[model samples]
Target: MDDIVKQALAKWPNVPHCTGWLLLDRRGNWRMRDEAAQAAGAPGEPIRHTALLGFINRNYEADDAGQWFFQNGPQRVYVELGYTPFVVRLAANDPSGQLTLTDQADAAFEPSAVYLDDEGGILFTNRSTPARVAVLHDHDLDLFSEHADLASDGRGGEFRWRDGAVLKLEPVRKSEVEKRFAFVASPAAYAATNPDNASR
Candidate 1:
């Protein structure tokens, strides 16, 4: 076991009842098995397994989740939890820890790279721009009332639940014709090409 994992184990002797836990590398590669095993206690025979990523993705379910990606020198450790948002307990070696919570109110949107509030609300950026933010009006019963359901399509694609509705997010890429002339010419180049143009 690594020093960080050991430290986490020591601090949280009894891991909270969560759907799944994932350990990933800096390159987003799965490092450990994705399973919610008993923390050396609590249930029947321990399910000894490997490939943590596969286990969690296959077995458990999650709605509001959090992930902590730690970097120290060459070692990169990523800890992710599915189902319930983890209660962050700061340790001595912890440089930075991140937590994210997504529920029924915010299921249709994508998360931004911003610090979350103490109550798990998404924080806003100082620089104003056209962006979407999902605010939880009723924190107590929002998630329970607007639970998302997971459904598998006849094909390999999976459907995600949003706002008490099943929404399919099929990956679609722009065509090559649509992607042409996408790069904007530099101002200097444009001026050189059109010297007489007044809009310099």
Candidate 2:
């Protein structure tokens, strides 16, 4: 968390929280949802400000209820997830020609497991106690395809990085992803059942 944000929280300890006003899309875009967009179930406009994006990335966190949010100074702006909480892209500048991954937050990702979803999305998870699941950017599918060794059925395979690290690919159901990964996909709806965690 940012020091300024921490000071704001200390100064105003009970600021209201917000929900359904921000979204993290599947492609890793940060979207700002207005009232009309929220009512119409739209993804809203993508936020392109580099400084704002960096701020959100720095303060992004998840609550014990599996709700992810950005600590915007004093208020907690809950994020609506389009898919997984994180989206990863194949790193472009690795000198060894090995497959490397970086998350939307621009942090290096080392996967302990790899999965291919029913919809053909590539997902990666690490060995953390409560693992984070990140989907590979669709645009980088071709690059990933070159490194993956798939079965004749393309149902299962192995990903071989040029650096000699290998990961076995497994099958995953899209519907079961949230439960399997222990992440709440729609935190607004989740809060409906646990109203205490809802916006103030």
Candidate 3:
């Protein structure tokens, strides 16, 4: 949390929490949902301001209940996830020739679990830290192919690291990702009945 945001919270402790107004899309774009867009079930217009995007990314966090939000000064703007809470991209290092995963928030994490969907979607998450999972953007499939050591998993292909690192990964169902990945990609569905169990 930023010091300025903390001070704002202290000064205005009763600010109302906003929901269904912000979205993080699959391509790592921050979108602002207007009233019309919310009613139409859309991700709304892309927020293109560089400073605002940076502020939101810097203050992005999750509550104890698994609800991800951006602490915008004093008010908490809950995010509506378009895919996963994070969207990660793969990049190859020039010196080491090693691949790394950087999330929508621009933080790199070691991928511990990798799953490939029938639609050729690449899912990855670190079993350590926060356990936030991400789907590689469709545009980056080529980049992902460059790093993945793919093998036949009987159904679809599975990924293996370059150094013969073998990790366990099952064919996970997209609908059952909440149980399999432990993070909520869609939050609005559970907002009325069980806000806290958004991911569950």
Q: Which candidate leads the pack in lDDT?
A: 2
User: What overall lDDT goes with each candidate model?
Assistant: 0.28, 0.90, 0.77
Order candidates by TM-score, high to low: 2, 3, 1
- Candidate 3 lDDT, 90-185, residue by residue in tens: 877799877777887688867888887665677888766767788887877887665555556533454655576755545667777766766555
Which residue pairs of candidate 3 clash? none
Judged by whole-model lDDT over C-alpha atoms, candidate 1 comes out at 0.28
Model 3 misplaced regions, further than 4 Å: 149-158, 162-169, 195-200
Mind giving the per-residue lDDT tens digits that candidate 1 earns over 1-200?
34555576566655432212333221223333333332432222222354443333233221111123332222223333221121111111234322223332123233332222333332211122333222222332243223322224322232223233333322222222112212111222333465564121
Reference-based lDDT, residue 89, model 3: 80
lDDT string, candidate 2, 1-200, tens digits: 99999999999989988888999999999999999999999999999999999999999998887889999999999999999999999854657576678899889888989999999999999767788899999999998888888888888899886467889999899999998988888887887888866767
| Shift in Å, residue 170, candidate 1 | 12
Model 3 residue 168 distance off true place after TM-score fit, in angstroms: 4.2
Could you give the candidate ranking by lDDT, starting with the highest?
A: 2, 3, 1
**Which 10-residue span in candidate 3 carries the lowest summed lDDT?**
153-162
Pitting candidate 1 against candidate 2, the one with the higher TM-score is: 2
Residue 197: error of model 2 in Å?
A: 3.7
| Model 2 error, position 78 (Å) | 0.6
What stretches of model 2 exceed 4 Å from their correct place?
92-95
